[model samples]
Target: MSEPLLLEARGVGKSFPGVRALQDMHIELRRGEVLALVGENGAGKSTLMKLLSGIYTPDEGEFFLDGEPLRATGPRHALELGISIIHQEFNLMPDLTVAQNIFIGREPRTGRVFLGERALEAKAAELIDRLHLPLDPKERVGELTVAKQQMVEIAKALSYEPRVLIMDEPTAALNDAEVRVLHDLIRRFRTPDTGVIYISHRMDELKAITDRITVIRDGRYVDTLDTEGTTMPEVISRMVGREIAAGLGPEGVREDREVVLSVRGLTTKDLLRDVSFELREGEILGFAGLMGAGRTEVARALVGADPVESGTVELRGQPVRITTPAEAAKHRIGYLSEDRKHLGLLLEQDVNANIGLSSIRERFQQWGFVRDRAMRARSREIVDTLRIRTPSVDQTAKFLSGGNQQKVVIGKWLVKDCDILIFDEPTRGIDVGAKEEIYRLLNELAAQGKSIIMISSELPEVLRMSHRVVVMSEGRVTGQLDAAEATQESVMHLATLRPETEAVS
Candidate 1:
């Protein structure tokens, strides 16, 4: 009977206040197959994952594993059953070593209480070696790179000898090379007795790694297809329930403009080194590179979030010193960070409050009283402008969908009226619909004479939005190409160029 499949979820449903987050969601995972669950933000992808991982009990239906009824009250119970989940957010203790994190609870006890570090390291090393990971079990997990930390998470999952593994956007934070490494790991983990449920927004990765595609839409199961037979557009149509229009905005056509931002001989300790670039008004400049190629650091340094020990930032024609973010703002420079939850939004605040945060001080009266009416009007304008889908302006930013929260972040910068905006991974966790909206907004802003520096790890987004592309590698600009001249191959070549190999004038 085909072993009754590894796992079967039947008619799962869930709801939140005034929202049916998931409904009649049916999915199955067989041993030796990678089942990819795909949908846009607010399509109930996370809710379904939560249900599968035992973070939430289904309001209606039940799941079966190996033909036996399974009811897990919580994630711990599910983990004990050999169903492991790797969350989008890394859950790790900074002070703990790699071995400690992997064997967090079930540590080897030497006596009745003390941890057996040597034994834990031995076991962790075995798992790491099995994954062909270069991680040192003795090293502190906090000291490792994001990619390495992710590998450790995978090793920890393997330690449980998981029969089914659930991964949520596993490659969102990884670089191109790291993504390649992870793809290989996924293949190795696929066995006749194991299954993997992969969740990701990157369409290309879905085509590359997944075997079966199950698309969900608006909390409902749409359909499933064989990955080899289906196309990206078809999957997108299923998830969105409509023909997704080609990405927003006019393709990069304004290459003949004067420079708006010019950075020469830029250098920061460890973060940036001799980086230089020129950005033109009404043009979207894309910065592309692998993680640790200094993309975030460059954005932070450009917006004065980090101080530069050397280099000059010129606005229009004159040189300027951007010692702080405020100074950068004064120069009409704005930055949207990649770390949205921590650095981008005030989660506890309402959408209106966060939208007006950067300009709240400016909008206040003589006794430092906030002009509530004025702020609300401004927030409303931006909300409508961005087409942010929220219940109301009073809704907490945290309650909004990932894509809407991202719009709130953009609205904050728009309120600041900064002409030069630096967006670091603008569509990082956003859905396809929201991504198009953001792209359109960016295009409109540029058309209105705002210069933009967009730092993206996604090559397609970079290609689609930028007027010119600047490839950064190892803290330096390796090459710059006009949109017409840039291809994935050419851009990647420059993005992966080694710092030591850079030619000097």
Candidate 2:
């Protein structure tokens, strides 16, 4: 008989109030194979993983592990059955040591009252050594960098001797070098005893590490293709279920209009130095760089969130002194932060509330009397235009899906009617559908004469969406590429282009 699959799900299905999150989805993973689960945002990647990891029990379907039917009531039950999931966000306790985190609930015990610290450390050390990770068992979890923290989480999962491992967006925060490291680590897990399910938006990484590519669209099984021969364009086509046309590059854009914002001889302490650029009206300008390459710093300085030691920001050829966000807003400049959860919206508030958050005072009447109806109407207008999906205008922003929440934040800025907008990692956690929607909205805004600067880590998004791309490395602009001339290789080269200290000076 042929070897049974390591794990399999049959007719897996789930439903929310207004959406079918998973519809008759089916998948299988072999003992030694890495299966890549890919789809646009809201393609049910996370929902399916939650089913596999027991975070959410499937309302319909049967799961089999090692040829035996299995059901888990919770994550702990899944762990007991040799299944583990390492989420995108690290779940380490700040106060706990690496060893303590690894052995949290299942710590070794010498007796009923005595804790076996030495044994626990030894076990943690063994897992670390096996994984070839350079983490100190005694080190506090909070002190580690994002990559290191991810390593710790992986080590903790491996501590269970898991037969199945689910990794979600494992390289989202990693730089190129760090991504290389992660790719190497993932390769080591392709052993005869372990089956891994990898979920990511990055097609290149998926192609590199995964043995098989499974495409899902609208929570339904699309197809499973051989990763070695499948093209990215084909995969994206399957995920989106539509033929997406090429985007307008800088040459394709109408640049006859005057420059809306210009930065001359821009310098900031350590983080940004001698940065200079000109943004044209009705254009989408992109900043491409690896993490810590000073893109966010540049945005922060430009918007007066960070103080600049030198450089003048000129609006339509006239110098403007922007000392604060309020001042910048007065000049019709707005910034949408990358870290949206903390900086962009009031998570607990409703959609209407978040949309009107920035200009609440203005929408109110005299003597600080709030005009609730006017604010809701304005919020509704933005929501309808931007296609923000919420149960109601009063629906809490935090409860909406990642894509919808992002739209609400975008709506806030749109309602503000800023002429020059800076979007930093705008689609970080959003699904593919929402990403397309955001891209459409951006193009519409640019077509409507809004000058935009987009900072993105994904090179494809930068290449596909921007009219012009500017690459930064080590606090300096390395090269400028018209979108037509920009490819993944050219952009990567410039993104990694590190100039000498003297050149930067």
Candidate 3:
């Protein structure tokens, strides 16, 4: 007989202001199998997970654990009931050690009031060791790399010994090697005692790791499929509700391009070691690297989001000091950060305000006063131009779908008329359909003579979108590849190739 369902979300429904995020969503995760929860960014996936985790109590429906109705009052209550989630955005105290972070509230005590550090580290080490994760339990989370921090999150979740473990975009920030570790752990956890709800936009992971796929669109359950019985094309089509023309073909490359953005000896905060590269007009140059390898750092430094210790940035053959994001904006350089919710958009603000923010003073200003009509008009144009699906331009960014929110960020740059665009993981939390949209936008921008520095963790994305690729390791550019010459093997080799000084990194 088949194993009993470990956890089930029964007719779940949830709503936010101006958004019906989830409705009548039903999903069953059976023991020993990994179930993929996938949909476009605003497809109610996050809302459903929140309901399952007790982060949000569903407006309707119920949850069942081992055929019993779960009465979880909050996230803590759910954790105690053996439901654990490793969030897409990490939720750890940076100042705390891995052991402390892992078993924060439930630390072992030496006496009535004192905690036993050794016992805590011992337990954390045991968990990390079991997973064969390369992480030091006693080390501070702040000192760890992004990939390592993700490992810590995994260890923390596993520490709960959860019957239902929910992983949201777990491998989003991990490299190929690091992803293998997670893959192995997933296989190891797929026993009669445990079930995993894996959420990700990456297609390959779903095919390899999941036993079944559950799709939700526009806050409603669409269908579910056995992994072995379906294909990605069909899966994507269902999630998007339309037939998508598959992948992009080789585009026309400029034979001879003029230099647009040039960085010489770009070193930053001891993370970036003598990083140097050049971008040509109408070129899509990709920055590929493992987490914390300084691809993001390089982009940040160029756009002055982070401090630059020593370097020279020349825009269109003119040396300029981009000391701040404002200065970068003045130079018409736009950076769409990988961490969009935190770094890119004002979540509480309306779409109109966000789209006009970067260009506030120049585009929608009049005599020290803002012109509301012009700003709204521009926002409406961009919303239509970018095909941003929203109720209206007045919709709060926090209420929009993840894919639409990302488009709002891009809209901000277009409003500013930015010539140099740096997109860091443009499609990180986006779905297959949205990913194609973003790719098409990038191609269109490059064709229109915009210089783009695309930073991505996905090798396939890098290969597909970029005309040239720069690979980084241990905060340094290890190698560069032409579009025709780059392969997964070649990129992975450079991406994992560490510098001698930072061998541990």
Model 2 TM-score (2 dp): 0.69
Relative to the true structure, how large is the alpha-carbon lDDT of every model?
0.83, 0.83, 0.85
The alpha-carbon deviation from the true structure for residue 129 of candidate 1, after best TM-score superposition, in angstroms, is: 3.8
Predicted candidate 2 versus true structure: per-residue lDDT over 5-119, tens digit per residue: 9999999999987678998999999999999998755678889988888898888998999989979889999999988999977788988899999888888776675467778
lDDT per residue, candidate 3, 354-389, as tens digits?
999998898789999999999999999999999999
User: Of the candidates shown, which would achieve the greatest TM-score relative to the real structure?
Assistant: 2
lDDT of 3 at 186: 91
TM-score of each: 0.64, 0.69, 0.61
lDDT of 3: 0.85
Q: Kindly give the stretch of ten consecutive residues in candidate 2 with the minimal lDDT sum.
A: 496-505
Clashing pairs in 3: none
RMSD for each model, in Å, please? 7.6, 7.1, 8.5
TM-score of 3: 0.61
- For model 1, residues 32-52, the per-residue Cα lDDT tens digits are 999999875567888887887
lDDT of 2 at 121: 86
Give the top-scoring candidate (lDDT).
3
